[model samples]
Target: MLAVLASVFVISMSGALMPGPMFATVLAKSYKSPWAGAQVSLGHAVVEVPLILLIYFGAATILENDITHLILGIVGGGMIIWMGLGMLRARKAYAGGTKDTPYNAFTAGIILSAGNPFFIIWWATVGALLVLKIADYGLGGLTALVLTHWAVDLIWLSIVSGLVYKTHRLWAPALHEAVFVACGLLLMGFGGWFVVSGVLAIG
Candidate 1:
């Protein structure tokens, strides 16, 4: 059990530390509020909880379907690429002192997450495997896995958001722009990969 929990923690952390739409959203939100990442993580939990349940209840088969993967990959990949471009555009607007309207960080989290096909794929594959391994221990194991994984996300994202908030004043505008640009590029790269994979699957 301890080993299971530890494994979940490590794997979850590895995912959380990856550069993706969620990370981009959190970084963007952190500029406005240090607690934004927490809100985002909570929103992430909203999607994740149901997903975990579905996997536990044998919904993994549906998620594993090639058609499902193809559709999600195409749609989600396009959305991610769009978001990346939006971020790039936002940088110029931000430099011009135009601020975006206030929105719920939680919602941003949900939207960003739901729009990422790679995220869905991960749960469908690697996450499903983990679920099977842990399901042997019953509901207790599932619960621990969910909670531990979420806790890791919350902790890591909170730290990132807090650092960005705290250091915003110390960082130059150019530095901020560069970070945003880098994130945007990474998102586009991921999006492109998803699209290519989807096409291959379809073929």
Candidate 2:
């Protein structure tokens, strides 16, 4: 049980640590309102709650479906690339110090999160492994799983928000632009890899 929890914690932390649209929005919001940034993080977490449950509960059948994995891998890869390019393009606008609208920030976080294929892949694969492994422990195991994931998200998001709040000057428009550009490239490279791999498998 301890081992299971540790594994889930590590996976959760890794995913949260990745700089995606959600992370970027949190940082941007931190510049304006830390509470709001937290709220945004909460909103993303709320979505994950259901997503995680669904993936865990369906792991057995879901993993058996080759076509499902193929589609997920392909879509996930494409989404990452799209987001990466978008982030790169937004660098200029971000560096210019544009004000963030509450609606825009919230919407951006939710949309990016919803469209994120990496989240789907992670939950479907690593998430499935943990949930299934601990399923024998019943509700207690399930609770631990959820809690660990939530804890990882809470800690990481708070850190991200805090960084922006505490170091807004250091995280000027230029810094934001640079961060996005770097994240974007990472996403693109990884996403492209997934897409290509999926295609080869299908072929």
Top candidate by lDDT: 1
Model 2 — TM-score against the truth? 0.69
Give Cα-based local distance difference scores for all models. 0.80, 0.66
Estimate the overall C-alpha local distance difference test score of candidate 1.
0.80
lDDT of 1 by residue, 102-147 (tens): 3567887776676666677789889998898899999999999999
lDDT of 2 at 170: 73
Q: Which stretches of candidate 2 lie over 4 Å from their true place?
A: 1-3, 14-47, 55-58, 99-122, 171-173
Clashing residue pairs, candidate 2?
Answer: none
Give per-residue CA lDDT, model 2, range 46-86, as digits (tens): 66777767766674455435565577567766775776676
How many backbone clashes does every candidate have?
0, 0
Any runs in candidate 1 off by more than 4 Å, and if so which?
A: 95-97, 101-104
